[model samples]
Target: MTNFSHRRVKTGSDPRRLADYAALRNELAKLSHPARPDVNWQSVEKRCDALFEQNGVELQSAAWYTLARTHLAGLSGLNEGLSLLETLITHQWDALWPQPVAVRMEILCSLSQRMQQLLRTFSPSDSDYSALNLAEQQLTRLISALQRRELTPLSPLNALLSLIHHSAVRLEKSNSAAAPVVENDPEVVLTSTGISAAPSPETTRSANEVKWIYLVPPEPQLATNPQIPPPAAATLWQPFALGMLAMLVLGSVALWSWSLFQRPDPLQTPLASSLSALPSVLSPMQLETLRQQGPLSDALFTATQQQLTRLSQLPPDWATDYSRQLVKQAQLLWPEKSRQLTQQWQQQVNAAALPADTMNGWHQGMTELQTLADKLNALDEKRGRYLTVSELKSAVFSMMTHFRQTIPVEEQLRLIRQLPDDSPARQQQIEQAGQHLRAQAYALMKEKEKETTAASF
Candidate 1:
């Protein structure tokens, strides 16, 4: 939506190219929904291939393509999904510092989700269980990789791993209850097919042998410290030392006097100059309050304008990071602003003074605001928040349902699209608000149906 053509730049194999790769990944994700029969897979593939050509097939591109392919293949119920996941897992392990650990974690989560989906479609006895088992193993390895790399494990990844472990346990329990017992020779190696069982003596021996080789004790080495003789103290050097000490003391006094005279006067420095700069650190409550204000309010609008002005004056590196923080803060404030706008519109609707077109514009604006708020809330959830994305999305969807009960879709779209793009925050708000409207439109349809039934009765 942000016109990738204007943003695109030809660059060599550098980490900065990851931005382009992420853009492609997002586009592919939008087109990869399984239930959307309207999506053209051939066109999606062609677009993806064109990106691959533009960037060249590097490890990062391979990762992006494999993830995109996994999603597409998964939708079609092709075994290629599982194969692509396996390839990704292998690539993650084999490559030297493959992609960012976060990207790897996402791939692992995707694989886990695909495997879980597959398990639902196939019978317990189907070989697809093996794929699930492999996915579980890969997740275990991914957890180890996170630990080994000393990276903090993402909350979602941990949740997914816990889920997979629980599912595997449940599957094992169910399989064991239905499985027939088959005793084998004591010497014969017995391995678990799908259910957990006692290992045979041969299997135990093999495992212990590997551990024994790696865990062997090493001989302790003696500890020693190097000793250097101190230099001899001589009266012959005393005269030089005394002269140097005298010079040092005199120089120190002179330097201190000069510094005192040269220091800037604290009273002359304006307090406004210091206060104009953004604080280096904000407290959590302060951050929350800043995030809850509506962008339409004069206070917030002026503050954001000032912040943007300050941002431009900052160094390039500082500006980049600060801009991201500003965007996130703006996003968080959207929901509260949306709710406020809705209330204002409702009051105007009862007044009967506003024209029909004016009332419609208010409704459209509120709808767009609420939609963007939901997405921002979803992004916040990804930052390890307690509220789940599903819950927030559901609530926003309910609000949209209420909106649609009063306004038509075509009018809403037109009004929302016509929203002023005077600032980056306004532009982003308009774009994300329109992007997910249709998906959330029916989220609360069943609830509406229930209410209708009750009312009719």
Candidate 2:
């Protein structure tokens, strides 16, 4: 290999030059460009030609010719640099081919600097970064070429392996370095196939000459962590540092995942469990307020009135033990008011007198009487288990349904205002029921759309 760090000699043939062209050439030689080992020359030439045409420059000058040649030479250096960058990307530095030790050191130093620059808003996709990498590679190759003949340094990759061997020899000097001093003995031939009956010292020595090649550590030989690199104390902590970072990131993710899996679902909590421990007893004002609550008060008032009206309609002997219990409970809740409401409803039913020839009014009054009777009957069945106002509220709320359908919006609002608000549980149940009804309606609408599509098909 020859050093290309000297100037082009000028033979004083061109006197028009202001300075010695040789001196300028010498400086230019020092400004060497790196070689790219794997760049495609055909493609580069085409690109260069296009650039020259675009730039409106003559390609006849010596400078232009040199520049073109330099550009082509840069391909090798560009390739080498790209390989390093690729190694960083893939993290397979140990797997790279043997490189000169100094070259490797220079590469590492240059890469460290380059990485710092790249870390400025480091975008892997940046075209500028790639171009800079190519430029650096070209520069490194140029320097290496200038110093190529100065005792070719050992490959950095090989040097690293040599270092390992050296370290091993240093540690186990006696056992590894001390060669066995063999006394030659007479050799005997076993067969014509070079098998010795009595081993010659030379044959044994040759047989013992082991050649070792390094391979990636096997799974069992490695620590439990797959990401961790093999321990190295002397070299830069690059591989180990990378491994530790990877392990840390993985560990954090695992911890986060475990926490998520261990966490309890909010929906799984028992329904209304928080509110179960409230005091059952209320002050007089609290009780009064509770009675005025829309749903609770409405259920109690309407259920009581209906029961009393049914009692008026039926003979005392005809009423069951269940009905009697409901009547008693209603009376305890509202004695005078229940009586008054029952009287008013009975008067309304009775006043609708129908002609003996027609059963219209009679049928209508009997229907109302039957509805009231059924409500009282249900109350009789449920009183023991149903302490909350929610149980009775539905019955009273249903009575307002017919009125709501027939009345104006203002009247409907007034009717709704009569509902009780004493029980949160009852309110939630009612809201859920309404939502279910709405969902069903939407489902039916969807079904209709599907049917329409089927018909078209």
Candidate 3:
């Protein structure tokens, strides 16, 4: 495939261009060690796009490469970055990048490494086999091209070959595996069709009952007709019992007649109270403060951003209003930074044209973030207070429910990425956690959908 950058003939050899490239590279490097990849990646992406529009072929290629790496760096995931990387370098690196062969080798090596990292992030069951195959094809092509250049098998080339072999083996193993992997869900489960509860044992068991062995004596069950057998005890109560039975029959008939005319009340659904629903907005400083609290805070931040990003399909007016509301609230909280943020945001809004999705999910996401903050605050308040076991259990269960509701798969992957890069254990953990979250979310959503459908009737 032809390199898109080769269509332009602009030489980016000027001193100023080189300086800009240096700055751009500096930005790209940050993604590799990003403290706030969610927040920072967008800006880097925008900058690269702008540079690509205004710069020469070499610079544009460089920009495209950087943009691709941003995805590799967690802007998206492996497929996107891999697609971009493959598109950029097919047969035009010399025209696209216009650098030394050594630099070319380095860039390709980095791409291979990133692909390796991305591959490691998936399990056999949930892996993107298509992506692996694509990467394998691309690696083969690149390695062959390098060979045609009469280049010896260097470390980078070897790495590419290694990944290709790994992909083949993986694909083979996946195809040859006879046993289907069933999701282990214990009692309540995500089945092939949907969520379901496993049946109790009693219905399927034999008629013979098993005796219970108890250290403490079990409570004896009462005989239903104990008083009827003892004539002395029964005789005096019989008249009273007959009177009571007559009264009960009359009351039951009257109640049944009343019920025939009464209507059943509709169930009231609980309102989902979120922080975004609050009267106030969170400032950037406050968001930073959230990040400072610890990993859960970081996860909360990450998860909120993710859910908020999904809300990006909102109406432009709604998005604008939501963002401005945030700006106004931040102004109330921190006048200094809010002014700058407001100006920047407005400029962006205007540039994109008003009534467009300007800040999708900011408001709703803030509410979710705020909801988490409130919950954490409540928990914090309990410090030094003696919490009963029941109270502790309720709190734990509530927090877990909120966590699962708030935190998405992305945050877990992000957290995993934050660990040291050289551990097989970390890779396995990421794959497990990611798959579990996805399956759990899918099951719950499907179950909720069924509930909604049933409730409508």
What TM-score does model 2 achieve against the real structure? 0.13
lDDT of 3 by residue, 1-457 (tens): 1112212112233223555456666765665774834335445544544444456334334434434543433322333333333334443445555467766666666656654564455454323344445445544655666677766435765675586568657766867764443322212223233222221221121233121110111245687877555446646788899999999999999999899877454431221231235345679999799779865647767878987896686542454455656777778778987888889976755444312232233444556567656766787778764547786576556555555544454776787888888888788876566444444443455579899999999
Candidate ranking (TM-score, best to worst): 3, 1, 2
lDDT of each: 0.47, 0.40, 0.51
- Any runs in candidate 2 off by more than 4 Å, and if so which? 1-416
Top-TM-score structure, candidate number: 3
Q: Candidate 1's residue-wise lDDT over 162-276, tens digit each? A: 7556655666666765554342321211122111111122221222211100011234556587587788777758888999999999999999999999987885365335335
**Candidate 2: 10-residue stretch with minimal lDDT:** 4-13
TM-score of 1: 0.26
Candidate 2, residue 72: CA error in Å? 99
Ranking by lDDT: 3, 1, 2
For each candidate, what TM-score against the reference? 0.26, 0.13, 0.29
Model 3: CA > 4 A from native: 1-23, 31-39, 56-94, 124-127, 164-168, 175-457
The sequence of per-residue lDDT tens digits that candidate 2 reaches over residues 218-247 is 233444666867786776688888999999
Q: After superposition, how far is residue 450 of candidate 3 from its true place, in Å?
A: 99
RMSD of 3: 43.3
Query: Looking at candidate 2, what is the lDDT of residue 219?
Result: 32
lDDT of 3: 0.51
